[model samples]
Target: MKAISLFSGGGGMDFAARSLGIDVLFANDVIPETELTFASSFPETDFHLEDIRQISKFPSVDLVTGGYPCQSFSLGGNRNPANDPRTFLFKEFARVVDTVKPKYFVAENVSGLKSIQDGNWLKLQLDTYNEIAGVGYNIATAVVNARDYGVPQRRKRVIIVGVRKDLGVYYHFPKPTHAKPDIAAKKGLLPYASHGEAIRHLPLDVPGEYYERPHDPEGNFSWYYMSRNRKASWLEPSYTIVANFRHTTLHPASPTMKLLWSNLADGWKQKWEFSSEYEHLLHDPTLPVLEKPRRLSWREAALIQTFPEGYEPAGKLEKKFEQIGNAVPPMLMRAILQQIVSGEGLLQFPSEHEQYLTVGKQLSLLSEEQDIEPIES
Candidate 1:
């Protein structure tokens, strides 16, 4: 079966689909900076760099998958649906899907979408899909964590998969190959990939750049992102990687550090002085300052997101980070698509591209964490 991807960000989902040997007829993304990255890996693909809304026609393909913009509905952004024009871009997705009439369609968004406005917006989006063209689609939506599917990061996303009603098929999500929770952890049921486990194989002396920034150099940085949660340990799976690399997860080599900010009558006083370029931070008198020697290099960040080794990205430093941060984490996409495509009898992977698919499939493929070696580049 062939595929046509929309709002494709760095082609993560595209790579996953191709891993299963699903040939992508065409693909489109809004960011021009990502074309080189996608093309570098998939030279045969017809890359379209433009807004999805401008797309009047799309190649007819069996599957359509994309992570429509979720900044507005994301918990990190203003939850106002009226104010965020990007959130409305789903309508364009609907337009293409309805026009092309693919057998299946998949859309990914931030899980916080379910909580915004008491889930009204999420319900509306699904309901709208039901009447796209004639009998529409039977859409199934679920919140999935990437760590549960062999990725090192604990990124949670709301995946919405729609099987065209005319196809008379239903989508079955893949079961978690990786485990979480204390019981599962102790049972040794494919424990979530640890920070160290995610990048232990790579040597610190690699020829590529190794950033030396000071921040969450010990654990995943979620403790500081949203209000700290119980699972806020740095040793656990990493936090959701956003496009902003500067504020991303610090390398695990550094010990855990804290930034103390307290409530004041006016509002709050921040311990990590924002104006100081994060060079000087204030911590509790009891907690000593941890001196971090390096930030997570781009390659390390990509590895944590389960991007295959030797999958050198394109563009400048910030653009490279944007492509990695915005991607769907191909490991997670493969988990879901593997199950879905298996049902469609699309299990045979093409020989030529099999190497690309196998990039990160070693221990991660089995959901078992293990030490890796320096990439054979």
Candidate 2:
């Protein structure tokens, strides 16, 4: 199968597609740093450094895959649920699908997209792409966690799959290949990959020939960031890695922040303090004080995201973190694409036409309920 990749940050999806023998004809992203990283990694692909709305033509292929920008709908960002221009970018995705008419299309976004504006945004997105090129598509959406797919981060994302109606196939998402240790034996699955296991062998203090050096923010933590525990145990998966380097998960070697107390009157406002176990070292002039708590290095973040070994992201430190955080974990993408191509999780629909009609009706009612309308582009 051939594919065209949009919003292709650091080629994570492209990497997975290639691993599965899917020929990616073209990849595009507006960020110059992403272009540098993607081109270096996928020199054979036609990498376009331009906005998606500016590009009017796309190569025809069997599949189209992209994890479009999700900031406006993400819980991490300002949720302008009603009229954020970025919110309408999915229409461009639909436009491409309509133009190329691929056999299948996969769109991914933050899990927060479902609850934005009480799901009106998701409904409008689905209704927009429900029927393209007149043949229509049987779309299925599911929320998947990266840990379940062997990635050492507990990141959750919404995966949307669409099969052209003429194919008459119901796409079933891939089941979890891994589970928490306690339930793994019962479910006959492998144990979840641990944060320690992912980066235990890498150099911690100094930069090696292949991996970058570890570093943390230089100043005090923000009130918003300090409100919750940022440290994960070595035995568990790391927290979600955000695009901003300053907000990435803390290294597990450091003690978890101590929660002093919570005030019930002010929305349960809490106070957090750094562990004082190492404070004695600060007082001793002869002994070396411990370095401040550091975040996962750029290479460490990529490792936890399951990027291939030795895959170096191009550009400065900030850009590297952004690309890695924004990327779809290759392992997660591979699991889904494998199921789509192999029909391993294929399901049979009793009445395909009726199902399609029902989906359309639900989307319509959802639009009416929320009184939220999609912006015209």
Candidate 3:
């Protein structure tokens, strides 16, 4: 099927849909940096580097997908402030959808969209879609965590799927493949993937520090893992991969690692500087400085979001993170696309090998005994 991606930041949604054999006919974004990356990655696809509101043209396709800007709707933002202009971009998405009339459409946003002032803002947004599309759209909403789709990240986002009313069927969200603490780890199942599992094999190319120097020997693991900290829970998936790298530190031995600060008394700063060894890791001048390199590399962040390795992003490093951080996890997108294509849900399973899930559980149990608090959301 053919597809068009709007607000296509670094084309994460595009990559996922394309990986599932969907033909991405058109990709649009207003940011030049993102457009460059999208163009480089999708050389064959038509890319529009203009505002969706100003675009006078659009392609008819089987699907229209986008994760519209959520700053206004995000909990970290203005708490779904109706006044924020970014929130209105959803209307632009709807406008194009109405004109092009794709068979299916998917919109993604932060989970906070559901809880803003008790969902009053979300209701208005949905009502607007209903009004614009005029009822042929069978809309369903679900909060999806990337880890459920084999992403090593625990990132959660709200996903909305709409099928043309004429299709005569409702779309179901993809099922979770990984086991949670509340659920038993099913063997012979797809073992829950981990942060280490996802990026372990990929070559590490640190920011502004390429592998070209004589002394810069290539290694099998990231410097982040050099401290040999115990792995956290593998079965439950990882926490979100935000733009800030300092938020990436959850390793027990890495005192420079900053856990997410939830409460005022969490002592985040102290924890970030508990040991001289870890403090040095945080101050490593080689690390990227946008948010903090303590989190993850841009490439690592892309992997957590399920972008395949060797995918070259366009623009500067910080721009790359901006595009990557805003992207949809491609693995989750793949599941969504599969459901759309097959008209049925895919089956998930536990693996007979069981080692992958078991090791993760064991490590998580050990960390809990040590009282290692997980990074905050």
Candidate 4:
């Protein structure tokens, strides 16, 4: 199989495609840093370093894969899907698929799209893809957690797959290969990967390995960041890696933050700070700072996202963080592709498509302890 990757950041999907013996003929991204990183790693691909809207030509291929920008529909953002221009980027994805007429195309975004406007936005997006030129497509969507696919982070995203109607492909999202400890034992699945497993091998003090540099302790940790616990222990998966390295999850060695008070008048608000036991150490000149609430380095973030240790994204610190945070975990994409190539998903008609959308309990962004209701398709 072959593919053209759009909105390709550091070629995460391209990396997975190559691993599965799928040839990636063309890749596109507007960010120069991403192009530099992508070019270094994938010298064989024809990469376009320009806006997606300006690019008009593409090679014919079997697949089109992209994870369009998610801020427009992200829970952490304004959540204004009704008027946000970014939310309509999927139409550009559909346009490319229509032009290439690929047998398969997969689009991914933050799972928040399912809840925006009560899933109507998702429904409309689905209809747009299904109406593509010729015989149209058989569309299926699912919300999957990165932890379930062997990534050491708890990132969740919605995946939409379209199979051309003429192909009569029997498609379903892949079954998870990993699960929580208790759930894995009962289901005979692998235990979830932990943050330690991803970054423990990297020597923190190594001078030459530039990627090992940690976030400055003096960097701002906004009130919003401290609103909940950001520390993931050695045995747990790291929190979602955002584009801003400063706001990334705290190192596993750092103490969990403590919420001291809360107010729910205008909106849910809370006051949090370093744990009582650890607070004294910050001001004590006699004691050595115990990691001092440092954010994960770009390399550590990359590892938790399941990128190869040797795969260094191009450019400065902030750019690297942006690429790594925005990337779709390669392992997650590999699982999806494996299922598609193996033809192992159960067969079903369009009416039963909703059953294939695997919705599960998700960790709320507001508080690590809160369990928000998942939107059903």
Candidate 5:
């Protein structure tokens, strides 16, 4: 089936759908840099640089996907999505859904949205979708962790899926594929993948200091790790790639020694040391010391987000991070796409009883692994 992506930051949703063999006929985003990246990577798809509000007509497609701006709804940010003008951007999404009337729609945002003003605000958000789409739309929401789907980072997002009501079948959320900390320890199972596993093998140079002209630019490695220490491993997943670039330093003792040294001399040492000590105090775990505020080359950041290593982003440095940080991780999106295309019906709205059952199962599993009682909130 075909899809159209709105608020398409660097085309994460588009990438996921395409990987699942779904065609993205059109995409729209306001950022010029993102539009450029989308154009370069998705040459076959039409990309428009326009405000979502200005798009009077949305293209007809089987699906619509987007992650509206969440700055207003994010926990770390001001919890003012309802009153912030940016939150109304969802209305534009709804407008497109109403105009295009796609078979399905997926909206993603930060999890803080669920607890906005103790759920009252969330209700209004849902009500808007229901009203705009009408009763035939079967809508469901879930708080999904990317780590549960094999992503190294512990990023949690709220996913809202809406299927045309006439389909009759409810959708269920995708099952978790990675083991939690307790499960890994108790069962002697492999822990969830770490950032190192994702991108360690690439040849490293100075962090964020690109070779003026690569000897084998096209044939050379696309990205490399940039950690605080030289001994840090790359075989695991990565830390969250936050919008604040200063926090992107790799672990100390990362295998990428050259990059670590470069970061240390360039003023990442103090921040890195502080973070390392803080983490040690909290967890008492053995970890290498590293420098902090080490910049991740744009290419590396894209890879951590699961974009192909060579996928060149459009625009300036700041613009690139904005797009990347705002994107849905493609790996997570891929799992969602698999559920939809396989007709797994794995996106169902659970009744209270079903939710209770699921929670019970989860708690039991956690208790078994942690050797402690599970406390329900």
Candidate 6:
């Protein structure tokens, strides 16, 4: 099947689609650097460096895959996706769907889209989607956790799959492969991927100031692990990968912050309080055991996002992290594709990949010219 990639940042979704043997007929992103990023990695696709509104037409394809600008729908901002110009960009997505009339369309966005103002915006979004598509389209929506789909990180995204009603098919999301973090396996679910297991091979930096770790400019490694005020374990999945470049998930090396909960004498006023403070350990009665804390490097962040090592991002250091963080975990995307595509017309999904899924340390997806030694186990 062929696809048109919209808002294709660093070609994360595109890469996943290609892995399934889906040809991306056209790729577009507002960020010009993304064109360079996608072209360098996927020379086959026709990369377009322009806004979605500027592109009057796009080649017809079987699938339309991309997550439109998510900042408006995200929780950190003003939470005005309903009225924000960026949120309306989904209409552009619908525009292509209407014109190309693809058999299936997959749209992804931040989970916050489900409810910002009592789910009023979500209702508007679905209504707009159905209106633009006219009739004979069945849209299925779900808020899925990436970790549940086998991703090492605990990222949750709202995915929508629309099938042409003529196909006589109702989309159903596939069951998760991984269970909740630190939870025992129950029936079919497996254990969540932990930070230790995800980047255990990458040698830890020797107490660094900067987040960037030098890896011979050809290899990947862990760099910085800035302290986060949270009590977590290497046994649990990494926190959600946020698009904010300024903030990063804490590493597993550090001790989980200690949480203190107590009830005060005042019944109605200040009745309860809780704290996850590291300061409490500074002057404790005895020495406190703690691992040195650090911030996740760009490579480590990308690895958590489930991108292959060879799938490098271009542009500035901050942009690299932003692209990776904002991207749809390819492994999560692959699982969605398997369910949507089924056995229709000779599928080549990760279910039976000839080589292997984008796991471990090697960049097996790359050609010999860009190949490097796999990270030691």
CA lDDT for candidate 4: 0.75
Which candidate ranks first by lDDT, i.e. highest?
Answer: 2
Q: Between 2 and 5, whose lDDT is larger?
A: 2
Candidate 6 lDDT over residue span 88-141, tens digit each: 888888888888888888889887776666555656656666665445466666
Off by over 4 Å in 4: 205-220, 259-290, 346-377
lDDT of 4 by residue, 1-377 (tens): 99999999977788889999999999998899988897789999999998888888999999999999889888888988767887788888989998999988888888888777667677777778867879777776767888877889898888888877788764677767787788778778888897765787775543332222348452346566776567776667888988876677776655657777878575766666776355424444343234555667778788888888788999988888889889999998998888777767535554243332322211112122221122111
Better of 2 and 4 by lDDT: 2
- What's the TM-score of every candidate structure? 0.77, 0.84, 0.74, 0.83, 0.75, 0.76
RMSD values, in order shown: 10.8, 7.5, 10.9, 6.3, 8.8, 12.4
* Superposition TM-score, candidate 5 onto the true structure: 0.75
When 1 and 6 are scored with TM-score, the better candidate is: 1
Candidate 2 ranges beyond 4 A from true positions:
206-220, 260-271, 276-292, 350-357, 360-377
Order of all candidates by lDDT, from best down to worst?
A: 2, 4, 1, 6, 5, 3
For model 5, the local distance difference test gives: 0.65
lDDT of 6 at 298: 74
Give residue 166's error in model 3 in angstroms: 1.3
Q: What's the lDDT for residue 291 in model 1?
A: 46
> Which lDDT value does model 1 have at 332?
92
lDDT per residue (tens digit) for residues 1-377 in model 1: 89988888777898789889999888888787777877888888988888777778778788888888888887778889878888788888888888888888888988777678767676667766776877677665566778877788878887777777666666766656667556456555576777556776666555335433337554333324323321223346877776876566555544434456644445443233112222222222332222443446678778878787788778877777888888899999998788677785122332221111222221122111211111111
**lDDT per residue as tens, model 3, 45-140:** 999888888996888798999988898877657674768888789988888888888888889988777667766665666666666545467666
What is the alpha-carbon RMSD of candidate 4 to the true structure?
6.3
**TM-score order of candidates, top first:** 2, 4, 1, 6, 5, 3
**Model 1 scores what on Cα lDDT?**
0.67
Minimum summed lDDT over a 10-residue window in model 3 is located at 368-377
Better of 3 and 6 by TM-score: 6
Question: Each model's number of backbone clashes?
Answer: 7, 0, 13, 0, 33, 6
